[model samples]
Each structure stands twice: as C-alpha cells, then as structure tokens.
Target: MKIIDQNYINGEFKTIDSSKRLTLKNPTTEEDIAQIYLSTPAEMDEAIHCAATTFESFSQTSIDTRMDILQRIHDELHKYEEELIDLAVLEFGATITTTRRRTKNAINLFLAIKEELKSYDFIKKDDYSITIKEGVGVIGVIIPWNANLAHLCSNIAPAIALGCTLVIKPSEFNALETQAFLECLHRANIPKGVVNVVHGTGEVVGEILTKHPLVNAISFIGSTKTGKRIFENCSKTIKRMTLELGGKSPTVLLEDANLAEVIPHVLSSAYSNSGQACHAGSRLLVPKAKVNEVKRLLLETIQKLKIGDPKNEETKIGPMINQTQFNTVQDYIKSGIEEGAQLLCGGLGRVQEFEKGYFVKPTVFICQDQTLKIVQEEIFGPVLCVLPYESEQEALNMANDTLFGLSAYVFSSDETKAYEFAKQIRSGRVLINTAASKAKNPPFGGMKQSGLGRMGGRYSMDAFCEIKSILF
Candidate 1:
C-alpha cells in the first residue's frame, strides 16, 4: 500500500506528526490502496506562516518571472501525466478516458494563464490618478475530491500568474494523486513557501485555513454547505473570497431541437463525472408534448454506457467514491420511488455483475413535481430527474427555480431562440448546444447562492489581486 505520511511545506515534504491516519480504498474493488497521516493544527499553522512569509517577496515578482514559473510548472505536470492518470483511476475510480481529459485540462490551465498574463495590464494610468493591481498575499485553497487536481491547478494557475502564494487543503480521499501533484510542483523548482499543501479532514486543516488571519484570501471548490461555513469563518478575518460552490444545473430541450442529436448532449451533461460534478445538468426540462420521445431516447442511450471498470476504455460510468456516497445515491433513489415519480429506467441496487464495489445503477425518473427531493436536491450520482413543462416561459421558470445557478444548457435548432432563452436563465455559464465551451478563456462561476465570486481569465486575476489608486 502507498503510505503518504508527509505534508508539502515550505520547500520540502515534512513528516506529519499527527497520529490521525486515514486509510483510502479503491472505490472499484473495496481494497485498501493507501494510508495518509493527517496534518495537525500546528502543521496547518506552520504552512500558513510559510505562505505569509513567502508573500513578502513572491508578491513583488515581475510578470515575466511569474510566467516562466507557470511554464515550468506546466511542463513538470505533463511529465507526470500518465502517473497522475493511473492514480486517479486507482484512488477514486475515475474512468481512464475521463481521467485523461480532466488531467490534460488541468495541466493546460497553467499555459492558458501564462498566455493571459502576457498581455495583462497590472497598472492603468489616467490624467488624474493611476490604478494598480497587486497580488492579494497568501491564498487559502480548499478543493473537493470529485475533481481535486483540476480544482487544484485551476486555482493555483491564477495565483501564480498574479504573483500570490498559496496554502492548499485537498480532500483526504485522494492522497496519492495529491502527492503526485505536489511532487510535480517540487520538481518544477517553484520558489520556497510559494505553494504548500496540508492533508487532513476539513474540521482540522480546512478550518485553520479559513479562519487564519495570515491568509489574505480564499478560493474554494466544494459543496454549498461547506462554502457557507467557510464564508462565515472568513468573516472573522474579513478575507477576500472566491467560492465555486454547488449546482443543480438544468438542461432544457426546445420543441425544435432534434431529439436524436440532443439526447446525447443532454446525457453527457447529466451524467458526466458519474454525475458527481457540481455543474452536472441533473435536472432535465422537456416540453410536455415530447416527454415520450425524450424518454425513449434517454432509455436507449443509457444502455450503451459501460459501467464496470474505471480503467477500461469502454467504461463511461464508474463507482461512487465510497460506501457513504453509494448509500447517499441509494437513499435518493428510494426517495424518488416513495414520492411517486415514475421510474423510467434503472432502479435501486448495484449492477448484477458486481458483487463488491460502490457501483450504482444509472437511474432516471419522469416527474412533473418540482418540489420533490429527487428533482430539487443535488444528488451527486448517475441519477437524473426529467421534468416536463408546458411553455417556453414555464421551462425558463422551472430551470431557474432552484437555489443553484452554476450552469444551464439550452438545446434548439434555432440559434437565436436558444441564445435568447439562455440569457433569461440565472446562471454563471449557459451553453447553447455544446457540452463544453468553445471559448478559450471564458469566465466560470455562479450567481446567487451558487458562489460569491468568479474564476478564469481576467476574473481570476482580479479575484487574487488588490487594487490601489495612486494620485497624480
């Protein structure tokens, strides 16, 4: 078994002194694969101090110097691409295809941020005064287990570009993968104390990062509940925060949309990352007249998805992260049945072939009630709720009814109509007909309770910066 007993602090990995150890199992085989010694409160404090100390010099780095660091980090990560992919599959049961795509995207974020920094203006001068942007000092990053590396790189890229230091707290479930990522950073020769990682439960490491006064800002990617708690905790220090929280995203199929072409896109959004994504289009909105056709297409498409082994190239869906997640998915499935929603396909229980593991059946339900728990809550599993609407306005209303406004999808043959409808949905990103964005550096974040601030491109640069006005 892989034993991870160190925390990456300052310029080196230090052995953790805490006796608290977390054993991680392969979600696919239910076999122990790694054990990690959790970081104690004292260790977390040391990491924060290191970052804070480094910020005094790191924050003054030139743009060209920071860009060079970003490039080097990107290259180092690429060297470990295959190892990271393997760890992702073994540690969290992610399919190889999904792992490769996410890993590539995560690595590319650094290059993208480097490109953004090339032409970025740090200071703007006018006849009266000059406005300058400087790094916001030490940043605290809290990442979730679903896409831990992606979140890590995404948050780190911007901090590096803006010459800010970081103290990261990654989820304990993916220790091996996190360790591999830290090794890459170490090999890249990043400046001492510029980036540090602490491994532990949220109650210990996460709380310290959020409440510490030395941490000037925070960037978090997790559930809304945790985000709210962090928000409350950060209030004590009045830290600048950029929160990328939960989502119950909607996929709306217009009357003019071709069901054959659109059903695949809908399923891709709904079930991507085994439906464990914050931005998964878990709520499907369809016209009342076409519910039958949509149902037929959905049932037909779900059968073709392979759900056994995550390492297999053919597997599109994989097991839940652990028994707790598996039980949560099962509970949601039970609620769907007890609430009187029609089970369109895939009921409770694991796939018949798997006697062990945390695999869950890809379930779907047809329901019109918007208040049902299955329809309203964020079930982070391969389960979808289909809601039928009478008119376009009703569809818009239904899509925006939830507490989340992270992402929304609109499908229509008429581009103008889809674009118009997308504008009305209250979300950070609204994709017309594609599962992924075609834009190179589109800003990403949510409105309302979904999040507090944005990340990506110039928005990320701004989030990690503090502005000052100098009088002429």
Candidate 2:
C-alpha cells in the first residue's frame, strides 16, 4: 500500500505529526488505502504565506511560460493515466470505464486552457484607456469528493494558466488522488509555492483558507449550506468568491418526445455517478399521460444496470462514497416510502450480493406531490423521483420551483421550441435532448442557490482574475 502522509508546501513535501491523521478508505472494500496527517493551523499559515510571497513574482510570469508549464502538466497527466485510473477505481469505487472518462476530461481541461491562452488578451487597448487582466492572487480551492480529479483540474487549470498561485484543500476521502496530482505538478517543475496541497477536514483547513487574511479569493465546489458558510467567512476580508454548490436539477420531457430516445438520456442524467453528482437530473417531469409508461421504462432499464464491483468494466453504478453517505441515501429512500410516494422500482438496504461496502439499490419513486421532501431535497444517490405534469406550462413551473438553479434539461421534437423553453428555466446550463456529458466547454456552474459564479472554458479565466483600467 502506497502511503502519502505529508502536505505539499513551498514546492516540497513536508511531514506533519503522524499522531493526528485521517485515514482514507476504498469505498469498494471499506479498507484503508491511504492515511494522511491533517495539516496544523501553522502549516496552513505557512502554505498561505508561501503562496502570497510567491505570487508577487509568479503572477508576473509571461503567458508563454505559463502555457509551457500547463502543457507539461497536461502531458504528465496523460503519462500517469493508467495509474490514476487504478487509484480512482480503488478509492472512488468507480467503474474503469467511468474513471477513464473522468481522467480524459481532466486532461482535456488543461489542454483547453493552453489553447485558450494563445488568444486570451491580458491587456486590451482602447483610445484612452488600457484594460488589464491579472491574476487574483492566492486562490483557495475546495474540492468535493465526487469527481475529485476532474473538479481539481477544473479549478487549477485556469488558476495556473492565468498565473494565479493556489492553496488546494481536496476532500480527505480521496487524498491519494490529491497526492498523485501534486506529484504531477512537482514533476512538471512549476514555480516554487505556485501550487500547494493541504489534506484535512473542511472545518480545519477549509475554515483557515476562507478566513486567512493573505488569501485573495476562494473557489469552492460543494453543498449550498457549506458554500454559504464560506461566503460568509470570505466576506469579512472582502475577498472574491466563486462558489459551485448543490443542485436538484430537473429534466422536462415534452409530450411529443420519443420515449425510447429520451429514457436513456434521462437515466444517464439521474443515475450518473450513482446519482451522487450535484447536477444529476434527480427530478424527471413528464406529461401525466405518459407517467406510467415512463415509470415502466425506468424500471426495465434500471434493473438491467450492473450494480456491483466498480472494477468491472461493465459496472455503471458503484457503491456510495462511505457509510455516512450510504446511510444518508438510505434515509432519503425511506423518506420517499413513508411520505406516500409510490416506490416504482428499488427501495432500502444494500445490494444483497455485496456484504461489505456502501452500496444502495438504484431507487425510483413516482411522486404525485411535488411538495414532498423526496422531490424537494437533494438525495445525492442513485434515486430518481418521477413527477407528473398535466401541461407544458405546468412542467416548466414545476422544474423551476426548486431552490437550485444548477442545471436543467428539455427534450422536444421542435428544436426552436426546446431552445425557447430552455431560456425560461433558471439554471446555469441546460441540455436539450442530450446528456450533460456532451458539453463541449466548461461554461458550467450554478445560479441562485445553485452557485454564485461560472467556471469553464474561457469563462474560468474570469474567476481568478482582477480587471484594471489604465489611462494612456
């Protein structure tokens, strides 16, 4: 077993007191894969100071230099693709196929950043004034456990490409992947202290990063409740914040939509990542005339999903992250049953075949009451709530009723009508007759309580930059 028991600070791996350590478990086997010492307050302070001090010079580095560094990092990521995928399968309980796709996405983001930097204008000239875009300085990135590798790259790609120094706090659940990523940065020979990694619970490292005086901005990806707390903490110093929070996304199926084509998309949206993803289309709104048929189709398809060892290339649904998440999802399943929602397919308990690991059956509930708890809250599991709608206007209203505005979907034979309807939904991005995975760029984030800012493609540049106007 490979053990990573140190934090990366000042361009070097430094050891922490082993007495205070966090053990990371393989969700598939419920066994310890790696253990990392939690960074002390003093260690976090050292990282912040290193980043702040380094930014003065690192932020001024030439764009070509930054692009070269990004290219090196991208190449290193590809070189270690198989190893990273193996770690993800062991730590993520992720299927090999899913892990490969995620690794590809991570690599592609860096490549995209490099390509975009070629045309990005750091200094724009006008008649009398010159507009300048510079690094925001000392970024604090908080990554959630789900899709840790992909989200880690999503933030770091733009931060580094735009010449910002970073202090990253990846969730303790998957610190092994963080260690591997930091190794890539080290091998790529990035400037000393330009990037740092700290491992600990969010309360310890996360709070310090948000409240640290030297930190200029905070970029977070997690729950709305936690995002709000980070916002409140960063507001004290008037620091910039880009939060990508929770989502209870909805998918609206039009009356004329073909059931065969739409069911697959809907299933992929709702059950992707075993329904743990924030943007998972947890709510499926179909015309009342077709609710029964939709439920039957869902049942047939869901039952056919291979729910077992994530190592299998064929497995689509893996175990939940840990016992706590497993219990949370189970509670939500129980809540649906108790609240009078009809259980269409799966309900309660583990996948009988597995004795260990946190696995919940892919659950589907046909809900008549939109006001029910199951329909309103984010279960963050492979649970789908099927809601019936009588009219197009009603479906639109139902979809927009949630507190989250992260993502929405519309499927229709009429392309123009679907486009117009997408405009009405309050979401950061909308997918029409397609899976969210088909997105080309990273212009993805949340609106309302879903999130505060956008991060993807050229837009991510906006997150880690400070704009200034200079008179000629």
Candidate 3:
C-alpha cells in the first residue's frame, strides 16, 4: 500500500480538484497496490502555469550550473534505483532482472545527458549581439507503458538539462511506478513546478496536456494511430512535437549469416518484453533457401528464453501488463492463425508453469504473405511472423513496406552487404548485428512514423531548446 496521491506542483505535493481517485493495480496478482489522484483540466492548467514560470529562470541558468543540478539528480536516481526497480517489477510485470537493468539504463541516460550537455554549445555570441538557445516552454511528455521510467528519463533528462520545464503524463497503466519516480525526484531535490506528474486516462490528462496554451512542445512514444491523434491535437497550437510511434521492424537474415549465432539476436529482438517493445524485431525475414533452417533455429532460440513470474530473477519473458493487453495479444495470435499463417511454434494461452498472471506464450507463425495484418500491423506481443523472400531486394522491400519505421536489423558477417542492406531499409535506427549494444550516448529516435526529432546526448537537449539568430 504505497499511496502516491500527491501531484507535484509548484514545489509542493498538492491534491487536484477532483474527488475521484484511482488505485494503480499490479496485473500479476490482480492486486490494488497504490492510489493516485486522478486529474482534471484545471489541474493540468496549474501544472502548465508552474512549469512556464519556472522555465524563465531555469532556461537562463548557466550550463555549468544546470549540469551540477543534473549530476545531483543522477546520483539521487542511482541511490533509489532499487526501490524504483521494485516498483517497476510490481507494476509493469517486468522481470526483476529487466526492471533492475532498465533502471540502471535510465540512470545512465541521465548521466550521459548531463555529460553531453557540459560541452554543448547551446549559445553563440557576437560583438554587437548574442545568439541564444532558449528553452522551449511548458513541455508535455507522454510516456508509453512498456518502458515507462527509462523512456521518461530518456526523453526528459535532456529537456530539463536544457532548461525546459514540463508536465509529464505517464501511461495510465504505469502510473504507480511514475508516482514513485516522482517521489524520488522530490527526494533528489529537483525544484517543484520544474517537473509535474499528472495521473489520468488519455482522454483527460493526455488530451489536456497536448492542448494546453502554455505547452510549447510535446514528446510522445506510443503506436502510430495514437501518435497521429496526438499530432493532430497539437496542430491546433502548432506545437513542436517529438513523436516516437509504431514499428513493424524486420530482421533480415542474409544468405551468408550463421544461423546458430544469429538465432540469439532474433530471439532477443522479437521476444523481449514478450515483444511489447516499439523496436521489437517482430517481422523476421529469412532468405528463401534458408527459411526452414532459420525457422527451426528461431523456434529453438525463443523457446530457450525463460518465461513466467515477473519477480523471478531467472525469467526473461514476463506477463502482459493487463487484461486488455492480454486479450489484444491473444487476438493477434488468433489473427495469425486465421490469416492462413503456418503455426510453427507457440500458439496461445498461459505458460504451463504460470496460471495466475496475464501471460502470453511465445508464439511464432510462418506466413507466406508479408502484407497480412499480423505481418504488417504492430502486434506488440510475443507473437512473431517469419516471412520468406526470394532475393535481397525483396527482403528490403518487404522490410520497408510498413507505415511504421522505428527500427530494422540485418545479420551478416559481410560488412559491405550489411551496410548496403541497412541503407535500403527506411528506419530511424538500424541494427547490423545487435541494437547498438543498448548504448546511452547513441541518438535514440525513429524516422517517419517512428516519430519526429531525436533523443539521447545533445539531441535530448535540442528537443527542449529554441534558436535565436544574432544580427549586428
């Protein structure tokens, strides 16, 4: 019973006008674990007001001073990392290892962003005039549930470092974790009103945050359909938005690839978080001649990934977040079956070892058509569709055929061939062997529907900054 009913506003914990409150639930055991204050439009306005007021001073602060505060935030983050991980494990159904690793990565991202900002030339000076990189005011951040804490810090650390104040609307599914993270922020001594967290459904908190007058910019990570709606909403204010949307990314296995070694990459790409990630390598494409061999390897590799309790240290695959997600994943599994895809491995239902959690089995389907719903859509589940292609050109074509272009992977020992194939696939990020070794300094973002703008390093700062031209 960790109750996070206080919304951070103006350097204090205050309750909103709404009498209605909600308890954040842990889906694994169907337990109500924490309570949050459900918010209103007026509460959103108050947050925007505070953030806007704080930005004037925060934005003009020296880079060195800002870096010092960021360092403090990072250190404090590391101190509470375990408790944060515990909350993540309980709320999001992430395994203990995943929760701990994700927390470290998030804290690392904060450190990396701080270091990146230290040497960043955010302003230019002239004899008669000065060019400034001023803060974008009253930012609105919408974090996805899959990797809520890390994703929040990943995009937000840089923004705050660049002197931007923001209102964050973390996914309703992960509100309890967010409340705890905000509590840590307060403990870390981040100035209130500099960052505010509001809890509610998308229609209430999300829509209000997007449409707020003082909110000059927005950053959202979710599906393309939702991203499109958010983009449209912000268009009314002509707000600058960073949209990290959907992905039906492909893993291309060249004819020369080693099936045994490459199989691990395929499993990690497609089945991590039960394949709920935006960049999960869901659509795995194998060469026509090697299709059967790769399929067998993929099935074996995926089967080896431990699935069950989120609290288990050995578990690699955890339960789906909630009943809605479980049903959606099951529907996708059913979609593959009904669409005439050959069921090569897992089909549906719970793992034999776990009966209580909202779990989905690791499912694989071999489909001839690359354009089917299961193939083309963002299933966001453990289900993977393996498609065969006649030639390299066809593989690249099919990989780039989706409306979502978040990430793409190519596995080949031939460097020249890998780079050539990477160029043809239209994605924001491309993984030749692995996904950039999960680095923090690498610029993280997607191209096209994957979203606009970039994050990580100086890119994170850029999202929060605006340029001013100097004329002498």
Candidate 4:
C-alpha cells in the first residue's frame, strides 16, 4: 500500500511530530490503498500560524505575481493530470470518464481564476474613492470525499489568485489526490506558507483548523450539519465564511419534455458522484398527469446506468466513497421502504457481477407525499425519489419546500415556460429541458441550505475577496 506521511507546510512537505497516520480504504477493492498523515494539534497550529504570516505578504502581493503563481500551478497540474486522474479514480471510486471530466474541470479553474483575477482590481486609486477587492487573509479550505478535486480546486485556486493563503483539509478518503495537486503548487514555487495541505478525520484536525484563531475565514464544502458546526465555531472570531452545504434539490419534468434527452441529463445530475453532490437532483418531481411516463423513463434510465468498477470506460456509475456512505445510502433506501414509498427499482446490496466492493445498486423510490422524509432529505447516493405533483404550482412548492436550494432542473419544450419556472425556483442553478449541466460562467449557489455565494467564473474570486473603499 502507498503511504503519504507529509503535510505541505511553509511551502514544503514536512512530517509531523508523531508517526500517527491515517489509512484509508479503497472503496472499490474494499482494501487499504494508501495511508496519510494525521496532523497533531500543534502541527495544525503551526500550519495556521505560518499561513497567517504568509498572508501578511501574500495578501499584499502584486496581482501579476499572484497571477504568475496561478499560471505555474495551472501548467504543472496539467502536466500531472494523468496521474491525478488515476488517483481520483482510485480514491473517488468514480469511472475514469467522470474522473477525467472532473479533474480537467478542476485544473481548468486555475486558468479560469487567472482571467477572473484580472477583473478584480486590487489597488484602484480613484479620486472618488479607492475601492479594492483584497484577499480575506488565511482561509481554511475543507472538502468532502465526493467531488474532492473539483471543490478544492474551485476554492483554493480562487484564494491564491485573490492573494490569500489557505490551509486545506482534504477528505481522508483522497489525500493522495490532494497531495498530488499540492505537489504542483509546491513546484510552482508558491510563496512559503501560502498553501498547506493536511489530512485527518474532521473531528480531529478539521475541528482545529476550522476554529483556529490564525485562520481568518473558512471555505467549506460538505454536509449542512457539519457546515453549521463549522459556522458556529468561526462565529467566535466572526471569521468570514462560505459554505457549500446540503441539497435535496429537485428536477421537474414537464409533460412536454423530451424523455430521451432530459431523462439522461436528469439521471446524470441525480446520480453523478453517486448523488453525493450538493447539487444532486435527488428529488424528481413530475407532473401528476405524466407520472407514469416519467416513471417509465426514470426506471429505464437507472437500469441502463452501468454501475460497477470505476476503471471501466463503459461504467457510468460507481460506489460511494466508503462504507459509512454506503450504509448511509442503504439506510435511506430502507427508510424509503419503511416510509411506504413505492420502490420502483433497486435496493440494498452490491452490483450483481461485482460484489466485494462497497457498492449499492442504483435505487429509485416513487413516493406519494412530497413531504415524505425520503423526499425532503439529501440522500447522497444513487437513490432517486420520484415524486408526482398535481400542478406546476405544486411542483414548484415541492421543489422550493426544502431548506436546501442549491440546484434544480426543469424539463419542458417551451423555453419561455422553463425560464419562468427557473425564476420561481429558489436554487443556485437550474437545468432547462435537458439533463446537460452548465459550465463555470454564470453565478452558482443556493438560496437556502444548499450553500452560499457562487463558485466558478468571477463569482468564486469574488467570494475570496473583501472590498474596501478609501476616500482621497
């Protein structure tokens, strides 16, 4: 098994005081693939203080210098993209196709932030008022196992581009992927202590990093409950925070929607990363009149989604990150049955041909009540709960009922109606008439529990910044 015992601190990979390390299981093989260091509280403190010190200079660095660092990071990451891709597949239990797509998308954000940074004028010396968008000092960047690469890249690249330092706590499940990427940062010769990567359980190191005094802000991507705890902790110092939290987002299927195209898109959005995304369209709300039709499509769609070894190019689905997640998904499936939701297809247990790994069959539940516990919660798995609504207003209410409003989808032939529906829905991003996801251009975030602020494009850069005005 490969073991990584160093945490990137003060611009270099260094070992901790003790030999304490964390061994993470390969979700696919159900065995240990690697071991990563778990930082002692003192080492975490040292990392934070170092980042705070670096921020003094980093926050004041010229945009050109920061831009150069970001450019180098982009270049180096591209060079190691293949290896990173492999690591993501291993740690992610995601198909190589999804791994490549997400990894490339993440690396692209470095370049994207470079362009976005140009739009952020750090030192404007106008007569009216000198307004500057500056970094928010040291940031604690926390990521989840699912979408590990994309989330961290989106948060950290923007911080570096905005001239802020970050202490990253990658999910223990994929420390290698995070380490490999940090290797690129180190090779970029980034300023000392500007970026540090640590690994451990959230209760141990993550708790310390989130509450550290030297940490100025927290940019977290995880469950809503954990986000709330982190938010409350940061409250002590009133540190600025940006959290991408939970989602029970819905995908509305209007009768006129194209079942062929829209079904695939909705399924992809619902099942990608095993539905672990904050934007997972876990709820499928269809018009009551077209209930049977939508159900047929969803049933057929979930059946066709090849779920198994992520290494297989033909595989469209894979296992949850670990057993805890697999069990969580299993319990939700059980609850769906206990709650009396109609089980159209899939339940507990592994895929037929592949039984050793921690895999769950892609489960779908058709329910009567939109308020059904299964319908209202974010089940981060391949489970999709199909719900039928009597009218458009009912569908809209069901979609907006949850505290999470991260993402939603509307399938309709009429563009105007789809646009109008999107306007009424309280979500960060809305897919219209298709399952295809959008790019990093427009603003993305949630209205309620889904998250805060937008990521990608200029919005992410905006999140890492603070605006100040100086009157001449």
TM-score for each model: 0.99, 0.98, 0.96, 0.96
Clashing pairs in 1: none
Candidate 3: clashing pairs of residues: 243-451
lDDT of 2 by residue, 1-472 (tens): 5567788998999987546876778888898778777877778888999999999998889988999988999999889988888888888787788889988988889999999999998899989999999989999999898899998898888998888999999888887777888898799888899888888778887899999999999999999999999999999999999999999999999998888778988998998888889999999999999987898788788877899899898898999988899999999999999999999888999988998899998888999999999899989999999999999999999999999999988999987899999999999989888875565675889989998889888899888889999996
List clashing residue pairs in candidate 4.
265-435
Alpha carbon lDDT of each predicted model: 0.93, 0.89, 0.82, 0.83
Clashes of each: 0, 1, 1, 1
Write the residue-wise lDDT of candidate 4 on 1-472 in tens digits. 8878888889888876667777788888888888877777777888898999888888878889988888898899999999999888888788899789888888888888888777776677866888877888899989888888788788878888888898988887888788888888888787888888876778888889888888888988889999889988999888888888888878988767877778888888888777777777889888778778877887787777887888999998888888888889888898999989999888877777886788888888889976777888888888888888888898888888888888888988899988998999988888776555555557777778777667777887778788898886
Which tens-of-lDDT digit does each residue in 1-472 have in candidate 3?
7665667788777876777776767868767887766788788778888888888887777777777777877887888888888888888888888678778988877778777876778677878877778778878998889999888888668877888888888877776677767767888787667888777767887898888878999988888888889999999999998888888889999989888988887888887776789989999899889888987787777767888778888788888888889899888888888989999988877767765878788888998997788998888888888999999889888888888888889999897989998998889888898843655466667877788888767877877778888888
Which tens-of-lDDT digit does each residue in 356-444 have in candidate 1? 88999998999979999998888999999999999999999999999999999999999999999999999999999988776876789
When sorted by lDDT, best at the front, the candidate numbers are 1, 2, 4, 3
Alpha carbon lDDT of residue 359, candidate 1? 92
Off by over 4 Å in 3: 125-130, 435-438
For model 1, the superposed segments whose C-alpha errors exceed 4 Å read none
Better of 1 and 3 by lDDT: 1
RMSD of 4: 1.6
